[model samples]
Target: MNYTAEAPAVWDPAFADADDCLLSSDQCVIHGEHCFVKGLIEIPVIGSDEVFSWGVWVSLSRENFSRAADLWNRPGREDERPYFGWLTTDLPVYSPTTLNLKTNVHTRPVGERPYVELEPTDHPLAVEQRTGITPARVREIAAAVLHPGSGGHR
Candidate 1:
């Protein structure tokens, strides 16, 4: 599915409370002026494909990043682990829609950084639902949507 809309805005404090924010990944990094994290969500489409996994990226504040890192490093505190933050980001391969996703962060290999598992949400990309899509197809769509002419790139 293809869509054209105004570029999605940055994290809006009016719509969310920063104090209650939780990001999905613990491997967030500071790039230039912004902190970024990536995760994946499975979209339930109504066809032979049933579901497809799509990548999602989110922006985080310094405070939230520190909090997530502390929680991530704390030992023997599995039960009280934090849920991924409800912060914001533009969908990597779709229209600049504001997506609120549920995520589970976990440790990867012995030496690698932790990663996140983004769950399904009622976002437009999930609802639009396509079938028989290849990784190449997804990449192409993303390239088109994130191209210079496609609104303002996030």
Candidate 2:
């Protein structure tokens, strides 16, 4: 299953016009200030090789953002150390909000999005990230995303 956010939660295109901001499929810079990158918060399926991914954005320091951009197209960039970032997308599926969670952005191959590893906290999302979830959980998530008003029912 997959869920995606178009931009960082704090992003308001009305305030910052196109010239002032730079937003691409994976990179973002708001008014030359806040920096963010789209990454995947992946949870492995319990009994299979499948994965559930949340396509979310993470805010990074200017230095980290620059480094990531620099290595964006470089081969073997996946070997670089993970970059520390703050989760910028608010995932409504879980409680206490998914915003501002600590994360380690692990760069992958040139074309793959970075893997966002949530900090080992007590939060449900983090817990699931650490421990694989069952197929039932994936089905439930799909239900929620597909029909929110029905309370996760088909």
Candidate 3:
């Protein structure tokens, strides 16, 4: 199960139509300054062999972004060390805001998006990543993401 946000919350929606921005489902760049890449934060689902994932964007330093872009299609890129990044998406279902959270963008082998690992913190999202969540929780997450103001409940 997964939910994907196409662009970071801070992004100006109109900027996508402008030539100054680089916009795609998997990556984004703004005026050559801010750079972001979409990666999966996979959380194991408890009581089952399943995973709940968020396909979210994380901001990377210009150098790291460039390095990632350079090796994006190359094999053996998975060997590179994880890049430190800041979460750029605001997942509103979480109470204390999911934006600006710390993360590590782990490069994968060819043909795969980077695996983003959230820093273990007290935040609910971070805790879920470390501990895992139940299927009921997964359904709630889906409801929250799908029903707007439902707050992940029936």
Candidate 4:
């Protein structure tokens, strides 16, 4: 069985509150932010880097960010109401583990927006350099060898 010493929490729609929102199979209302549609947009996929960099960032649903944006747009909402959180990326890409990275877009929580770093963790390319893969010319040769059809090889 797939096992890890540190397993993550199970998906809980109830965890979504006014300050946080969790997208799941159903449109669940937790905290205070309401879901206008039920299971309409797949979690994270609607807002991921792959989609944002090439496609969905501009032409995607205006209604996607509508709720939080609408609340934020109001002046009184910022001061009076509880600050709702924001999805990590405007375009969240789905991963095997949890849903898309989410962060609190509030100022009340003190410093830093509640978002996850989108950088690669423990990059193989970075680690390979320490493994005696020195010389730019060697790297070029390896690259050409690995991907012959890339037109880098002779």
TM-scores for candidates 1 onward, in order: 0.40, 0.93, 0.95, 0.19
**Deviation of model 3 at 38, angstroms:** 0.4
Backbone clashes, candidate 2: 0
| Highest-lDDT candidate | 2
- Quote model 1's TM-score: 0.40
Tens digit of per-residue lDDT, candidate 4, span 102-133: 22222122121111222233332212222323
Per-residue lDDT over 11-118 for candidate 1, one digit per residue giving the tens place of the 0 to 100 score: 333423344433333343432344545443444444345445444454445665555556655564344443455424555554545555545544333333334444
1-154 in candidate 3: lDDT tens per residue? Answer: 9998988877888787878799887789987799999999999999999998898999999999999999988889999999999999887778688999999999999888889999999999898999999998998898888889877522
RMSD of 2: 2.2
| lDDT string, candidate 2, 51-89, tens digits | 999999999999999999999999999999999999999
Q: What's model 4's overall lDDT?
A: 0.27
Clashing residue pairs in candidate 3 (N, C-alpha, C atoms within 3 angstroms): none
Question: Local error of candidate 1 at 33, Å?
Answer: 16
Ranking by TM-score: 3, 2, 1, 4
Candidate no. 4 TM-score: 0.19
Better of 1 and 2 by TM-score: 2
By TM-score, how accurate is candidate 2? 0.93
**Where does candidate 1 have its weakest 10-residue lDDT segment?**
2-11
Q: How far off is residue 41 in model 1, in Å?
A: 6.1
TM-score of 3: 0.95
